[model samples]
Target: MSLFKKKKDELNYLIFEVTRKCNLDCQFCYNHWKRDNDPKAEPVKEGYTFALKTLKTVFKQANPKHVTFTGGEPLLAERVNELILFCRMKGATVSVITNGNTGSTTEFSQLIKVGVQLFELPLHSYDQAVHDRMTGVLGSWKKSKDRMVGLMKFGAYVVPVIVITKQNFSQVGETLELLNNLGFQRVMLNRYNLGGAVLASPEKVLPSKEELNEAFKQANEIAEKRRLQLSSNVCTPHCVVDPNRYRNILFSNCSTEIRQRPLTLTVGGDLRFCNHSPDVMGNIFRETIQTILEKSSEKYSVVARPDFCAGCMRYEKCRGGCRAAAQQTGGSFNDVDPLVNTIKENEETEIA
Candidate 1:
């Protein structure tokens, strides 16, 4: 079977960019690429009635296994609980990614009761000052930390995402220790993808391979010690830091190699390429979910593998590195992943 060909039934994950309004101005927000230059400009909130109506249409056509509600902050959207209830009614597990400062304890509990099974919260570091600085907000650390504990108390599954960057890269171990102490069982160690606002100052934001290697080393050790689950979605080339070396850490395969792709339905009713990339593949209002996935697969195939990746034993596993990262940093999907300096050989077999 052709790699890019996916059955319509294979669509499993869908994201609803519920709103563009956010409370904080993070240094490395992927969505900043589309944000207004004037910070004073009012953020846009999606029409709640229109969103729910469109989502109902989508669910009628195809019920996805997982549906995510995200935005500058999902909680900012009025009547978001109704949307959660709708997804749950459609038999889709619901998740929401938030900055953790928007809603009260009562509001959060209401969301959990309405069927928000999971919440992805961002916690840059254990140090309060560092966390607040990264978020460009004062005292946000306390709110986020308190809310994470509060959500878990409400019986909701919460994953604290640590976006690895030069600023907080050295504090990985400290952050992991804090999460472990807080009783977080699962954590995501994410890489700062080169996109959005960071494109203007990529050097200051993107971590060096050496910085990442050290961070991973700390993460691997702490994960085993604390018995915490550490996973990453960013495509780090195997040559940069082999996943096998860190037995405790889980590095996900690039989606371009997989049959099922995570599709994001933006607030404007358009489907994005993925969560990180700003590229739009199709619109939810105009195209069916199956049609969007099929067209996206064609675009995925166009992303070329790096020349050095040819016949490498791990080629199938890594897919020559993150196509989204390549497109953003190198200006083309065919460009080599910025993290890769040289091809590292596999000990068991030579490159063909």
Candidate 2:
């Protein structure tokens, strides 16, 4: 039997964390758990040799159709162009999520020349002070905004990302307006999960269910009016938005489906289920990619949904909400997601 029951073509998305270093210190960064103990933990600015070896394994095993280069910041990786070129040579289209800090116009041009299809840039809020405060950097908002504009001029497809948190939830309208003014065709708004840096400060960063629902409602309204494509992470429930209007924006919450695609290679050569997961299934340097994935499938098999979830109307699509969020907050992957519970409570209150 195949390690992946699905055909090879089904597993065609690979998310490679090219490096572990980042320029800005965002307060709610999901990768914060990686920085827990090491005082010397700075971004691994350059690692061509390790990266090349890892990419070789990925190409040999997965031969992905889409490769998303993420990191502390993929642009900060040494010889990143070479890595992007390697993916292109293997017939993979590439995209990158960066803090929008590094890279000259020439550097970005070179990357685009190598077939980078999209650039996902972060934009926290319209208010510079709020953004800067969340990022823990004095001038990140300006730098990121400037970079977004510069990338747009370069004709790179850029999507501005807003990681919704308590600090920025209320400003969702203004943020989308700013993105629209900047001429962005699409924007991504992700809810802050209780992982990484947020684990240390969930109370400070994570927004309440009411806050998140309201923000999405407002943002969706603005996005529709401006004809901007809005995408989101799996943290929100379908009930939060108009299902008919935002059907495409709602994401699947099934770990099984997610695990079947998008193999993640960390900077240290560890294969992860996702960036938010701390579990290292196997090391690509030591084991074959196929072998590593097989191990991951066995060890990280999908969690069984609770009985209550089976009867919910949105059960088929939502699949019991985000597994990582449940694990982080409720201490088990199978625990009912707090967001779902919150929505249920709201429904009960209304009925009462």
Candidate 3:
């Protein structure tokens, strides 16, 4: 901890991707792969046992503030119940991010009993037709919405995140109003990053600065009128947008909204600093998770702001949006943009 800078001590959020298998084929999946031969592209068939033991060892070694399970869809990952139980035994709060069609109410009830409190469901649009077209499923839209109702009724924190795209960006205001009407806890408006199959459409759908400003503005109206709390990312501050007093509230957080919970572990049982960094300290299967963590703290160093981002105040806000994306697009932290940096040497041109 630095004396001059208040380093965040509450380090306990883990974005555990239990599996890589997904149900719906959304064009904008952040985890989509190209060659399919990448080792990272593979999803482990090993379920709760591997994950349970891994979680147990990691939790015992480090006290996490919270644990968030995501996926291809976490519920589809077998032994989800076991992982939840282990987190509870370790006294860590548990959350799951799902598309919401993987489990039944019974499965959800089991999760709730095991101390799972936070649930995030992604709904691309309020209109079923558009959403289904985007997700390539007939009822994916309704199923996600219905599942949100279930979680809310069960008294769990259910947040819905919409990946803004040309397909759904126009109706963001309406989306907020409809979700508020449905009794949702919160909603985050995230622009569609160029990843997955949607990369070609990035500029067509990503939120304009003005659109984001309106999203924040509309969220406030829903907060005041519908008694719902709403927010948008990179668009508004967390304290002002997240509703606390009223029954219904809407809010948003730009990506990196909250410090992400730690997720990856080294092949040696040491935890990977962030999902983006492929390096590892140790492996839970080989040794103890904490032992490795304590031995080598240097491996997980925080990312220093790169030169290209040094002049941008929003650099702190973005912190190199996605390291994985950076790697994929060949845009290191030092570059202004990926495509610009990728210009071939033979293709160099001089403008008059």
Candidate 4:
């Protein structure tokens, strides 16, 4: 089977968690991004060599429609240029999600020279003090914003991801206004997933459903007015826009179109199925791309949940989703069932 998938397994989004180490600790971060427990050892530039080999395998396996570079902070990872090169090596449009604190604008520019098409960063709060307070670091707000400017200066497409929580929800308008003024092409508004220890206080992290719907409506309105894009993810909602033009949205609960994705390729080249699971799908270095898919597809059959899709009537679409967050956060399959069912009921009522 040569093990390299031709197109059947082609994915719409390939999210790679290149590393677990992060510089600053955001209070509402869903994963324990702050606590990188790699009893294995500390991070070093040496990691990139391993990264290059693994990426070659990923490019062949997924045949991604779009590939996203992500991490505790991807810019902190070694050989980002090499990784971008590999992703571009594929036909996939390349993008990255980052915290924007790294001090390598030149390196970022170098990646831009290639086919890295887009950059999404944290645009948490309008005021530096407020942003810094949420992130628990001084000057992070200033540094991150400056880095966003750096990305735009390089002529790369940019989108800022702001997680909505108690502290920052009230200031969403201010944040969007600033991004619009700065001429960013888009902003993705994220709802905090009360999963990791970072968001132990559900009270602070999970905004009320009414609040989220209202905010999404207003943000969409503002984004439309400014001609900017806003998006959310992780089982929140869905809104398909003009084939080319985009809008602010939640990335959560997307159809199976985006589920069943491995969150990370380990240092050893194994595909860890989920962020919290960290279990491997065999080492890509040893197996052919086709074999990798066959194995992962089988794994999904055993673990993926199709019946209780949280926000999808099309359970067959995304399967059970990446259940790592539910595992770690103490939610169950039932928790998501209501989400999908409730939305469906409301949708049906509206139609009726």
lDDT of each: 0.78, 0.75, 0.60, 0.63
lDDT of 3 at 210: 43
> Candidate 1: where are CA atoms >4 Å away?
1-10, 35-45, 257-259, 341-352
For residues 260-345, write the lDDT of model 4, one tens digit per residue. 45345554565554554433556667885456656666544433554454455544434444354544444543233222333555
Better of 2 and 4 by TM-score: 2
> What does candidate 2's lDDT look like per residue over 1-352, in tens digits?
7875534433567789898777888888877344355332454424998889778766665657788999878888888888899889888899999888788878888887776899999899999999999999999999899999998898889999999899999998999999999898788888876666666557798787788876787787887788878887654455554345554354445457544545677766777777665556788778876777766675465547656576667755665665666655535555655556656667899999
Q: Which pairs of residues clash in candidate 2, taking residues 3 or more apart in a chain or in different chains? A: 21-43, 21-72, 33-196
Clashes of each: 0, 3, 29, 23
**Residue-level error in angstroms, candidate 3, position 192:** 1.9
Among the numbered candidates, top lDDT falls to 1
Q: Per-residue CA lDDT of candidate 1, range 186-212, in tens?
A: 999987766666666777877777788
81-128, model 3: which lDDT tens digit per residue? 777777778787888888988798988988887778878888777788
Candidate 1 structure, TM-score to reference: 0.87
lDDT assessment of candidate 4: 0.63
Off by over 4 Å in 3: 1-11, 32-39, 43-45, 197-228, 231-282, 285-303, 313-324, 333-352
